[model samples]
Target: MADQAISGDRVSGIEDESDLKRSITGKLLFFYVLGDVLGSGIYVLIGSVAGAVGGAFWLSFGLGVAVATITGLAYAELVTKYPQAAGAALYVNKAFKNRPLTFLITFCMLSASFAAAASLAQGFSDYFSQVWELPPPLMIGLLFIVVLAVVNFIGITESVVANVVMTVIEVSGLVIILICGAIFIGEGRADFGKLVEFNAESSPIMAILAGIALAFFAMTGFENAANVAEETIEPQKTFPRALVGGMIAAGILYVLVAMTAALTVPIGTLAGSDAALLEVVKTDILPVPLALITIVFAVIAMVAITNTCLVALVTQSRILYGMAREDVVPGVFGKVHATRRSPWVALIFAAVVVGALLAIAGQLAVGDPAPGEEKTTALEILVNVTVVFTLFIYGMVIVAALKLRGKDESEGTFKAWTPLLVFGLLANAGLLVYSVINDPTSLIWCAGLLALGGVLFLLERAFDRRRSESV
Candidate 1:
């Protein structure tokens, strides 16, 4: 069992651990969930959805919200059911009890994080270009990683505080769009009916599903909150409410933001540039007399995403450390920070890997993919593979949900159950299949990463077997 501590003046002897406390209430949990799920996937990929689904971008976003909400519902159920700090990887380890299996799941989580962070850093670098023309994408990318690494190494307090401030700042951008969009629509420049335009001209299902992939990125951080259950005030009670409620709220906000953006800007335009929010501000659509307002919004978005990037790295390290502690990877990876009680070794290794990816992306990024050619950038190709790995990890968690049932019957407390988890797993698998067929770039990488994981798993198993025999 995990460590335990007392609450109030009660002698329940059955107290949760006070060491490494998170003090997360339902409200704060909501914020954590909201911030992660409402990630800058919108800021960076608004254009991607626009390009794919054309005029009905809001419909695409709405579709994304639905699909993510389905997965979110499953996550909420599984997390509430188990109430453990390990989350999906923990669940996988508990279910399989295979060192190699857990290692791969943990690695998937870590790899997905690096891929996402690389994307975020790429977004940051792109935005940085708005302010200054830096020729070196690699240098700027490394610089971004360094800043985040430093912040994470400092302490959890700094990371949380930074996330809170950045989330608020970024949320303000959406609110601005909401307000500006309201004004634009009221002034007769934008149309409300466009939000429901399931036109007969195109395959709405295909278009919407394709857009759902982009939206999924915006909704990436829901399961992450489950991993922090150990830190929360009350695992069984606090996590479920926060996890479910927070996701629903974030989904609503995303839909609103999408509608507002779609309404304020021309569909043709929104489909063209990723900086659609900036476009809305520069044009005379909204009531913001000053374009500086949008710039502030952009800054807020960047800060929120940066905070997200940092937190993700922190989560990835913890997952890797936990896996290593179970003897999945090696004893070396289980090393903890003597003073901080954090996973120093994993953090350093993760930073190195991400830095390497950024360096590669900086060197190889090109303007566009050609006919008979793949993406000209290493980062672009690698990012696709990362997404595949991420889906694979999420899929495992869904399966873990089913396997962990009755495995730890001693933890009497619970929320949702195994059936919901199975449902989620199936949903995720379906979507993953769709993504593999539609997005081949990510498909190749997913296969490669899993293959890489398979090789490492065998080696680790053989090494552990030798040690066991010697002992």
Candidate 2:
């Protein structure tokens, strides 16, 4: 097949008009990845990770960085090499030469994105309710999705500029928590030795590995960065640096926050509290009034969730638009707005799916709350599903990198280290197996979703054949 020209109006010849605007510069791309990588994962996954790894929670997060970096290298190489909007699905199609497989990978990315958006919506609603009484969480979550979709339909540059502002505010919140931890240490109220403590029930290595699997959930935003390649200016020259730099910066910041959290707060206390980071802030070290601290924490949590959902929705819509261009799904998804130059149809479709997931998941969990807990908390379940799907996607992407390693570097492309690619493959495979063992229900969800993708793939294929014969 011939490659498409780089016309502003058509994204890979899929649209009749010009495609998404190429306004994202190197700096904007950096913040986009940084803000997205530092998203709801830290806000929601920290406590869950602490529960798994005890006081040595930093170890798990560090390990997650290492693993994410390995996979990130694969993404960097592939995104620069292809420089398209499809991301993993595009690489898979190129390497494997299988249309059905491509559709499956594309759908997995979209579904995982929806899961992330849905989980973040619930988080937003949960925190919003803390500040003010609200209607049912499902309604609030749906409303948030609708609002995000509107912002997305407006323009990519506008969406990403808003993200940069949110990213700064969110990072500032983490900085405040770090300062509070330092104050506690100066007062000699906390034991720094606790930073190395491991849970007595499990061996140290086993515990850290378990924590890595959970921590890996927070490390996934880097791949979504690849989905925006088509919208970035000079992606081949700009994406590799931004992607790797953003991941490394986010990892260092995460480790610092995890270490400060471990040293300043009791593992048991942090593990048990849903608002674990808030607990660190509300400690006497900050010297803020209780009501003021509560409001600050709520606002920060809402910003983190909003940043996450916004990025996920953007990535999901682009993936659908990419797949639509290939006839893997309906063509309407590839329809770009004539004036706005955005994938308006795909944007609305993604928002509706995310809203439905949030509504259904919230209702299901609400019906089965544990005593004293406000709800049954299916957020972790949704997060788990995303992790599983992402792991498989990561595995395939690494495989694609290996498959494409032989391509020339004449265009400034380079291959990741073979050992790192192998290691990433093994790590992803191991984590997928472990996740299935721990939460078998996640596999059922993955299976059902993949099956849905298969049905759509067959339909699109048949439709293409008929259209060709008619022509």
Candidate 3:
């Protein structure tokens, strides 16, 4: 059989496209999707779940898996169906047949991508801080941005290669955690009951779903895989497998990890710091090797997540380029780098914007005077708002998958199974609804941002028309 995917085991293809023109081996596509979806969200957010859900921390993780399953099914069918390079933007536009709707989906994704990048950079700063009493997060975030930019500018191939290696190492660390937890069970320090119970149910169904939304954040990167459809070999088949598999794996890991953490360490200790996983390894239950393993996992986890974020940011720039290609913005932004075959202009611009956001987060965390003043609180506020914004975009994607069921088979392979799309949209919509109800303030902020984005998108079109009329 001909290959239909890009990254061999890591999922990058030779030029990474699918058509009558290119194909990838199914297994290679599976691993590529696996590596891509398994990036850093779960590693970093484990602490947050413990903080919110108490002793039954795995419940939060279980919620994430359930939610991800619903959304993953939707994405699988769509990627198999459309196989377009445009991803969420293209799908929604096709579904609604409205430019504004398309533009909104693209804008929401770009903003959410930027926020996610910023969050990762900030998280990177936190981890680095644990190792080095080094300079503040601002300096760290800046340095981190510089490091990734240089790597990205080198070539997409290099970055993808690095991503694959990182994915392997990170998954190894998670495996080590399970092994260590098993040892703890032998030592008799582990409490199996706390891990099994869902005592948090007293909080109401909506509250539980609200916690699930945050937990759902851990299972995110799968959708962004679609953005690489242009760079995928047999995207139609490969993306569906990778996206769904990655999601399911992450969900299971999160649940098991949460269970073990609850069993060994008290919820108090886990919630005490951002480096919650570190606490688990340091406890009397496991020896230094486990902690050491987690430290290694930390490196893989952070780099992998960072790598995923870089891919996502690149997608955001592509949308900008696509908009420019459609005359929605200046044509110069549309030109791809002749040498690298990457979007150089968009890359630089996105790096600067996201770097700025990270800088703000750094300043806010430590109570710095300048942007730091509002940076911490504002970022916290935006975190929840970003949840709403991202889900809204996802909801659109689900709808888009349903809408494009009958496009030209000449266009791609793997059209979404229609029933799955409906199920996925409702899942996404449920999360969106929970986000609004639980944190109405954040929802308001998201709506305002969308309004602002709407105005800018429309004005860009208006300005383009004026320029055309003058010509």
For each candidate, what is the lDDT? Answer: 0.67, 0.81, 0.66
Q: Which prediction has more favorable TM-score, 1 or 2?
A: 2
User: What ranges in model 1 sit over 4 Å off?
Assistant: 1-22, 156-161, 196-202, 284-291, 339-342, 361-368, 372-383, 403-423, 447-471
List model 2 lDDT by residue over 378-455, tens digit each: 676777788889899999999999998776355578567899899989999998898888778778867866676677
> Of the candidates shown, which would achieve the greatest lDDT relative to the real structure?
2
Q: Mind giving the per-residue lDDT tens digits that candidate 3 earns over 140-194?
A: 7767876766567666534455556766766776776677688988888677777
Instruction: Give the lowest summed-lDDT range of ten residues in model 3.
Output: 372-381
Clashing pairs in 1: 5-16, 384-442
**Clash statistics: count for each candidate:** 2, 3, 21
lDDT of 1 by residue, 233-349 (tens): 765677767877877787777778778777777767876554665666656655555656655766766776676677678777776677677666666567877887667777787
Q: Which candidate, 2 or 3, has the higher lDDT?
A: 2
In order of appearance, the predictions have TM-scores of: 0.84, 0.87, 0.83
Off by over 4 Å in 3: 1-24, 156-160, 196-207, 230-234, 284-295, 361-382, 406-421, 444-459, 462-466
